[model samples]
Target: MALLETLVVVFAVAVVAALAVVVKTRLFPLREGEEPREDVAEYISMMVSVFYALVLGLCLVSVWDNRATADDRVQTEASALHQTYLLADALPAAQRQPVRDAARAYAAHVVEVEWPRMAEREPLGTEGWALLDRLRTAGELTGRATLSQQIAAQEVLAQLGYVDDARRGRETAAGESLSVVLWTGLIIGGVLTVAFMFLFGLERNTTHVILVMGLSGFIAFTVLLIYQLDAPFGATLGVAPDPFTRYFPL
Candidate 1:
């Protein structure tokens, strides 16, 4: 509930900030009663347009990198899990099934249970990572066995280690704080740029007004979309866990 409220607040602030640009420009004239500075205003507008373009480019690149990072983390984790599964054959007969079961169970839990909570930005329940640890330990205990089994056991342990590290990476990546800051800059930049639209005693040109408002609206909307999707695991507008789900039982 608290997180939802925070998200709402973030969203409200962004929307208001974005719309403020349109309203400040179209409805209220900031340069009322001032003499025209046509040449200076035109130059400033051109510069601001460039600024807006750069900001937009930065936002797109930032979000794209975040998505790619999350996807790569998923692939790394999945690869480890699969490798662990195959390496279970190295375990003694008594321990082989246990390790395999744990691996599959962890995958299932991630898909069916953890994924939903993560999507909602909720912390995962206990027993999820615990189960993974158990699988790792089970693999480690295969020590001093047949050489082939020992090698296999080592591979499984290595893969399990990979899974642990990848999971940690996912946690860090999913936070996506850069998006938050980018949003702040984007929205503030948009508002300030548009506010400048009405500055300094300029004669109202209908065409210029239309162009300014249209550009403002588009920039604002694109930034908002990027903000919503910045968190790859977030429910608002993020990557779905269905890909992870496929590895699970249910």
Candidate 2:
């Protein structure tokens, strides 16, 4: 969803919840002797809030670490590709241009074609692997080449190995997400945390409304933030193709 739409939903839920608390207090005012036991309620509420906070922390950490790993993969892949490109200079005259061209083509495909697919959470298929294979084929040299050329070819292969590993890491990161069980816990926890506020019988209806609204709004924002970060490539704070562009500007 767009930022504006998300904000609207968050604010709408908060306002509706706050209004419900208002109506609830009006309809069922707590009498002096009828007020629920504050001590027990406070204890339970504190425990629930603490557990919910733990869940939120776990979710935030999971997504943040995934994003950081995705970023690292991008940097590694781009650096390896750049190294391969530079190594092409030491190759034989007949082989140098092909290797460089293949490197450029692979970079272009990643930045222009594959990036959008990743952002859309679409299947990458085998196109990227095929491109990488082509790069490997282009770098191949005959036994007629000298020792230096052979050594350059070996270095190029090593760099391509890094690129392959990093690409795999990147793809895995793109598909990674919290499991359904964790998601269920997160949602249930947030709801219970917010609902606990309703059990309290504060003297001022205004104060009660304010507390519920603030807690609900903050929880809503946190959940949404986690959702956005769950998609490492697609989210607003997602990994970018800047590493590729920096190495092979198009």
Candidate 3:
């Protein structure tokens, strides 16, 4: 729904901009005596276009990489939790169920509680960390144990460490976004790129209108795409929590 709303708004703005350009041309039709300096105008517009393309490409790549990294972190966290759950069998009979329960609880919390908060860009507070600590406590053996139990405990701890690291990465990525400076550049550059179309002298007014409409629509769509990708876990192009569900089956 949000994505559809965004698309409607962007396209509406583009249409309005195109109409404005057409009205300006109709009101002040290029006078017979005046001629557009195509040489200078084309050169400057070309330079502006090149620079804007570079910036657009950079923004796209940055968001794409961040989203991919966020996805990887989720997978790693889920995989580690699954490993820890499996290792519970090797622990002492008394501690086995507790450890498995802890692992399940942690996974469930992440999928049900923490995920919605991340999606909404809300603060996760300390509950997730507290749950992680509880999982660690459950897996640790207080008394002396056999070699196999000791090894299993250590492996569980190691898996938990991976889960911790991945969780941190996931949290960081959830809040990651493009900086203000880049956003300003993107907006200003797109405007300039489209505005340049009006300066060119076209033999037919229809041609001029068509060109402006196409340019405006395309630029608006690109900006919208970047905006959607900027929110790694909340926006239209965000990463899903399928990894967690795959391993821990909510």
Candidate 4:
């Protein structure tokens, strides 16, 4: 619903800008000798358009890569936890169940609790860290044990380490967002790019209006696209919990 509202707002702004250009042109007609300056205006507009395009492209790519990385981290974390669960089977019969249960509980918490919180861009809290610590503790085999059990414990700890790293990465990604400066640049640059279209006078008034409307609409659409991708886990197009479900079904 928020995304839909953003789209509506951007579209409305674009339409209003286009209308303003039309009204301005009607109110103050271009002078008879304005043709000589058009070449210079066109060159300046072209440069501004090009620079803005480059900035937009950079922003789009950065957000897209961040989203992809967030998805990868989720998948990696789930996979490592699943491996830890399986490694538990190699431990002593008494120790195996606790490790497996801890792993399962951690995965469940992530899918059930942390995911929703991430969508709201809120911290996952200490509960998740507590669960991870439980898993680590359960996987430890410091007491007198068989050689095979010792080796299994080592592997389990390693896998837990992977899970921890991935989880940290996921948390960081969830909290990540585009900087305010970048957003300011995108918004101001978009307005300038659209406003630049008004400088050149076209042969037909309809042509001018259509040109402005199209440029404004495209600029608005690109800005909205970046906004959606800026927060990897908070947007509708965000990374999902499919990885957890796939490996550790409820």
- What candidate 2 gets wrong by more than 4 Å, as runs, is 1-37, 203-206
Candidate 1 lDDT, 187-235, residue by residue in tens:
7678868777667443579888887879778877887777666767777
- Decide which is better by lDDT, 1 or 4: 4
Per-residue accuracy of model 2 over 49-97 as CA lDDT, tens digit each: 9999999999999999998999999999999999999999999998889
Per-residue lDDT, model 3, residue 141, is: 91
Alpha-carbon shift of residue 70 in model 3 (angstroms): 0.6
Which 10 successive residues of model 3 have the least lDDT summed?
1-10
lDDT tens per residue, model 3, 128-193:
899899999999999989999999999999999999999999999988888766787799899889
Better of 2 and 4 by lDDT: 2
Q: Which runs of model 4 end up more than 4 angstroms from their true locations?
A: 1-36, 203-210
Is 1 or 2 the stronger prediction by TM-score?
A: 2
- At residue 98, candidate 2 shows an lDDT of 90
Give Cα distance to truth, residue 126, candidate 3, Å: 0.6
TM-scores of the candidates are 0.74, 0.82, 0.82, 0.81
